[model samples]
Target: MEEAIFSKLRYMKKVLLIGGAGFIGFNITKFLAENRNYEITVADNFFRGKMDVLLTDLVDKYKIRVVNADFTNAASFDQLDKDYDQVYMLAAVVGVKYTEEIPNELIRINAFLALNTLEWLKTAQCKKVVFTSTSECYAGTIEAFDYQVPTPESVPLCIDDITHPRFTYAVTKMLGESGFMNYSKVFGFECTIVRYHNVYGPRMGFKHVIPQVTQRFLKKEDPFKIYGYDQTRSFNYIDDAVNGTVLAMETPDVSGEIFHIGDMTDELKIEELIKYIGELMDYKGTYEYESAPSGSVSRRCPDISKAQKMLGYDPKTSWKVGVKNTIEWYVNYINTGGDVFE
Candidate 1:
């Protein structure tokens, strides 16, 4: 009996999350730890991803291995095992603020991270990889070419202006999408790409719209300014996004496929989102409408029919419900003196 148990344990699936300490990464780690029996290792630089109480609790409870290293340096890959059964590449310098403030660093870090991972994958014996991308890659297509709403994955990716700083994030993601796909093809390993759309939830840090709105409401901003009031986006709660991502990793015969994981039915305008959040926060404040910042997409929603049919990806959380849950969490966290994280 002891020998049999040892053999089974030896065959357990080994998983690696390259940037697994961040918002989505930590959630994915928690989900897998709770639901699956795989041996999980999280490698992150701790730059943006934090070593907060929540992560510490999960790691301690699940006995998940944590490797702290800067992956942008190619040498850091040496710290991870090469025989993982599954790998998740979620590392990137994301955020519009960064694009506007430090576009050069954004390009350099994201590009090097993708390239280094690809070079490492060339030698690693991992079975499959999931590269998390963003809807920004095709945002230019919608704005510049009048692309259809509820956009499909088949939509061509275009940069509205190569010289614009805002396109830096999308440009790097495009490089990742191409680099991971082609490298996987040549390296004889399976690969899938997931383009996430406005994924938000509790503990997701304050850089996103939801948390920022929650903070503004907490601060009791009178006549709260709602930027991009006319623009629309379909928000995908973190739980639903995690489900789709795990499905992408575990499903069979799906290599080389790109799936847009988002809630198609929950698309709402910025004004609607802000007002709803205001209501949730019990804000009896007036509102001011403002134009969206430059380079912001006018309308954004994904045609998730592909994810639904191919991966059985269905998002269950309504925007209102998700927003309420997110707002509540942020309120509590801030009330209890939670540190602001990016």
Candidate 2:
């Protein structure tokens, strides 16, 4: 019986994770390697998320293959195996900071990554593809058109102002959504889209609000500034996001479908989120409110009912529990003087 079990493990599915070095990709890779007998290959450029000790440990433990290449270049896909059973396309320049600083570069890199990968799939023998996306693609629709809260995937994507640098990220994602669905239909590959909503956790680097807030508190900012304090968002813990993503990939007969993978439990205000983080950090500082920049959606949350019904996706982490765990990790990481992010 044990020999039979080992035999099954030896012939597990071959999975390829493009940009798997990043936060979401890394977690997904880890989950699959430990929880399932998957022949995993992580392809990454490490432009934003670095190959830190954690990912190195996982690769070593799982015997996973690592391909280091900038996927922004069209020919880079050749370095990867065309026979992968599954592909997770998570490569892209993310974060609001990048959008504001280098919108043109964001558009260029993201669009090319999507297009190049699509062209590769046209000939590749992959059975299914899961393309990671963000809810920002529909931010303008909800804000401008007053779309339903816990916004569904059916909400038409909108660009409040194409000229605004922030919308550049959304524009490229919109292109990926349209391009991948259409390309899959034409090219005969199973594809699923999971739009992540405010997914956050430790080792996600210092770009996001939670980490930024922790840094400010640790720096002893006497007057803590809560930007977009009144604006609200529903935060999805990384574990929930990873699970939903895997479900979208593994579930049967779900091709050409879009699922909003996020937590709809708490639509907390920005000020509320920051204060909770501050409380965890034992912050006794004063607080101030600041305005969100242009093109920033005032309110956003995904209606995850579709994912719940179709994929059996349910978010299990609460803001308090998730925030506590995240704060602990960042605090320990900072206190240890780890220069991994640098």
Candidate 3:
């Protein structure tokens, strides 16, 4: 009986996470490792993902397989097994800075990454896949056409300016969404698309708004500049985002469907977010209002009713509470001389 049980456990469903070392991917890996018994493999090029202590610790504890290879090259797919039960495509060059600095490279890397993965899936016997997307894809729809505030998955994806560098990331994501969904249709596999809002939490790297705010407060900038102070966003905590993604993958009969995985209830202004962080950091700093960066969306909030109704998905973290937890973690990390990774 003992030998039989061990054999069954060893042959359980296998899950693959492409680009699993990044902030959201790593959190999803951790969640699955803690809650499920499935065999998990994390394949990442680490372009932005780091092979740091946190990741190594999880790998060691759970015996999770980590594959370090550039998935941009079609040849790299040869390194992976063809029989994965579920695959999470979370790989991308994601950051506003990168869009501004190297839009060409961002386009090249993200487009090739999605195309290569889709081609690989055409032949691989993967059962299901979740292609992670972003709210940026529909930002132009809202800005140009003034679409619904709590946007739904059906909203038409548009880019305000194709010539602008800021839209580079959105363009590639649009490609991924179309490629993954259509490929799965013709190729006879399962596929779901999830567009995430501003998902923030601990260990999310210093490139995002929350961490950048934390770093500024740590430096004690006297007049804290609040860019896009009036612009609104619904920030989803990392844990909630991970839960939604898992549900999208595990829930049946949801293939070819797109779900907006974000907290619709936590919408707040950029000013409110910055001021709250200041209060948390105990900084007596004055505020400076500034214009939002060019091409930035003025407002973004997802309509997650579909997810809630279909997958029973609900986000539990209030922005204030989530922000507090994130701030505490960043403060502790910085105080302990934590070097920036990713």
**Candidate 1 lDDT score relative to the true structure:** 0.94
TM-score of each: 0.98, 0.97, 0.98
* Candidate 1 C-alpha lDDT tens digits along 1-342: 999989879878899998899999999999999988889999999989999989999999989999999999999998999999999999999899999999999999999999999999999999999999999999999988999999999999998999999999999999999999999999999999999999999988889998898888888998899999998999999999999999999999999999999999988999999998888888998999999889998999999999999999989998888988998999999999999999
lDDT of 2: 0.91
Model 2 TM-score on a 0 to 1 scale: 0.97
Best by lDDT: 3
TM-score of 1: 0.98
- lDDT on C-alpha atoms for all candidate structures: 0.94, 0.91, 0.95
Per-model tally of clashing residue pairs: 0, 1, 0
* Model 1: residue 180 alpha-carbon error in angstroms: 0.6
RMSD of candidate 1 to true structure, Å: 1.4
Clashing pairs in 1: none
Scored against the true structure, residue 248 in model 2 reaches a CA lDDT of 99
lDDT of 3 by residue, 27-122 (tens): 999999999888899999988888899999999999999999999899999989999999999999999999999999999999999999999999
lDDT of 1 at 119: 98
The sequence of per-residue lDDT tens digits that candidate 2 reaches over residues 1-342 is 999998998779999999899999999999999899899999988897687889999999999999999888888888889998899999999998898888999999999999999999999999999998899988988888898998999998887888899899999999999999999999999999999999999788888888888889999998888888889999999999999999999999999999999998889999998998888889988998899876778998889999999999999999899999999999999899976361
Residue pair clashes in candidate 3: none
Poorest 10 consecutive residues by lDDT, candidate 2: 333-342
